[model samples]
Target: MKAAIATSYGSPDVIHLAEVPMPTPKPTEILVRIHASAVNAADWRLRSANPWFVRLVFGPFKPRRPILGVVFAGEVVGTGVAATKYKKGDKLFGWTSLMKLGGHAEYVALPETGAFAPIPAAMSYTDAAAIPFGFGTAFSFLRKAQVAQGQRVLIYGASGAVGSAAVQLAKTMGAQVTGVCSTRNTELVRSLGADHVLDYTKDDILAKRDLYDVVFETVGKLPFKESLALVKQSGTIITGSEMPTQMLARLFAGKADKQVKVIGGTALSTAADMKHLAQLSAEQAILPVIDQVLPLERIVEAHARAESGRKVGNVVVEMG
Candidate 1:
């Protein structure tokens, strides 16, 4: 099996393609022949081991997992005796947990009970593989915010992977969605169901007088404090990165009035959430906005593109 492995954390050049042993499934796992995978910001973040603090998990000097990919869309080629939910040739899409990152290979073995879900008839492998990180993150945050119909929701970086998904999900939940992006993506965000589009590059989102019931900062730019004024009383702010000190202060201050809440972290995805997303796709209620698709051999280049943090949506890596 050929895989792109990282022996140490640095530039995308550190990742190189090489022949590696194919993985086998354990009694509770399944061996998937990967067809496609998507690169999340987490992939590059882990590769470079940025922020210094994350080195505790990735490594102080190098990555713990040599092959770095989390989301995958593949077919079950073999399954362990204990795996009953799927059999040979079952097409699925999902992600492994934090400790089991090996989706960059031609094949990977993961627990059958992980976030895996059957790919919808309407979804292609490329699109299915793109779901876990972006869609899963959006679902988790919206669920946390308890989004409801008619609520005013603001989404920063509405053209990025998670931001794009958040716009669609917020619309599905009947929120009046305001998406912040660049002028180039205003139409794209509108097509994704954002009720309003603001170009953060030209306009001042903080200057907007309308307050939001929920503020979702998907790009990790604009500190929590800067967005505080936009949140309505008793409203909440959700970010896709770790909660910093300023966010903590708002979290505590809001407790007395419960007017504001700051939340952040990777989402805990479930098969049920993936299934729901599949249904939405089949119904054409939600469309996966893929920015580009690259062959697995070009993974290093894909990492570079993802690192720019300017992509309009998910960038997929086709494996098979």
Candidate 2:
């Protein structure tokens, strides 16, 4: 099997194409012939081994997992003895940050019980690959904050994968969505159903006195204290990345001060979320935006593209 293997953790240069042994399924797992896989911020974060703490997981010297991808849309080539939900030849899309994060390979073994669902009738494998990380993360965070209709919600970095998903999900939840991105992305964000779009470069996020019921920071670039103030009394502030100390203090302070929530770990992948996203995709209620698609051999370039933070949505690596 061919794979994008991380020989060492550093620049994207460390990632290279390699001929590797094919992975076999465990008793409760399935061997997937990967059609496509998508990259996430976690991919580059793990590659760079940044923030120092994460290096503990990736290993101080090299990546703990040599293959570096988590979201895949593939066909089940074979299944383990205990696998039941899917049979050989089932086309599926799911996440595998749980089972060693090896989706980058041409073949990967994932637990059948993990976050996966049959690919929708009308969806392509590339689009399905985009769903697991972007849709999954946004779905988890919005559900946690209990986003509701008619509430004013703000999303930072609204053009990126998670932010784009958040925008549409907030709209589905009935919130009046406000998306914050650069001027170049204002229209893109607005198209995702944001009621209002703010170009963070020219517009002041905190200048407006209209408090948001929920503020989602996907970029992790906002100052926690300053950004939290944009929320209305008892409103929530959610972030994909870590929140600073003052924000944690407010979060621990309980619902009295708008119940700030700093989310890090993802929600358990549920069958329901995958089905709902698939249905939405089929109905054209939501669209999976693709930033780039690279061949399996150019994974190093794909990682570099994802690390740039300039990608509008998801980047897919297609297996030839």
Candidate 3:
């Protein structure tokens, strides 16, 4: 098996392609021959040790897991004795738990009961590879906020992966959606079912008097004060990307106002959520937005592209 090995925590240049031993399924696991995978924030964040605290969880000097990838779209090639959920030839897509990241390889073994779901018949591997991170994160946060029909919802970074999914899912839940993005992505956000699109460069979001029932900050760029001001009394603010300082401040925000609720944490990726996302994609209710596709050999380039902050959506890598 071939795999992209992350030698250490540093630049994308640290990742290199090498031949590795194929993975065999454990008693409750299935062996999957990967067809495609995605390069997401998780990949680059772990690779670069961005937050500095990442070193505490991953490693002090180097990464614990050298092959870094979380999202995978592949076919089951074999199953262990206790793995009954899937069989040979079954096409599946989902997240490999952060603790056991190995989606960049040509093959990987995962628990059958993990966040795995069948790929929709109408969807391609590349598209399936793109959904788990963005859509799954958005779905988790939206459900956490308990967004209901007729509620006013605001999403920042509407052109990015999680932001794009948030716009579509919020509309599906019947919320009045307002999306904020760059000028070039205003139309793109509108097409994704956002009721109103605001270009961050031109629009003064803080100046707007209308208060929202929920405000979702996907990029971590929105200030806590601004988020608190945007939400109506007794409303919710969900931050998908929270800096350490923001996380600390949110603890006292609810105490200070006693009217607004602040929510921040890692997104959950469950099998049930993956199944729902697959169904939505099959129905064309939520579409996967891919910025570019590269071969597995060019994973370094893929990492660079994902970290460049210019990609509108996912960067998929095909395993040939």
- Cα deviation of 40, candidate 1, in Å: 1.0
* Model 3 segments more than 4 A misplaced: 251-255
Tell me the lDDT of candidate 3.
Answer: 0.92
RMSD of each: 1.9, 2.3, 1.2
The candidate scoring highest on lDDT is: 3
Against the reference, the lDDT scores of all candidates come to: 0.86, 0.83, 0.92
The candidate, 1 or 2, that scores higher on lDDT is 1
Residue-wise C-alpha lDDT for candidate 3, range 236-292, written one tens digit per residue: 889899979888877666535637777788998899999999999998999999899
- Model 2: residues >4 Å from true position, as ranges? 243-268
Q: For residues 207-297, what per-residue lDDT tens digits would candidate 2 score against the true structure?
A: 8543888888887777666556787876777867663454465455444455555555445567677877877777887888789998888
Q: In TM-score terms, which candidate is top?
A: 3
Candidate rank order under lDDT = 3, 1, 2
Candidate 2 colliding pairs:
149-174, 234-258
Q: Candidate 1 or 3, higher TM-score?
A: 3
Provide the lowest-lDDT 10-residue window in model 1: 250-259
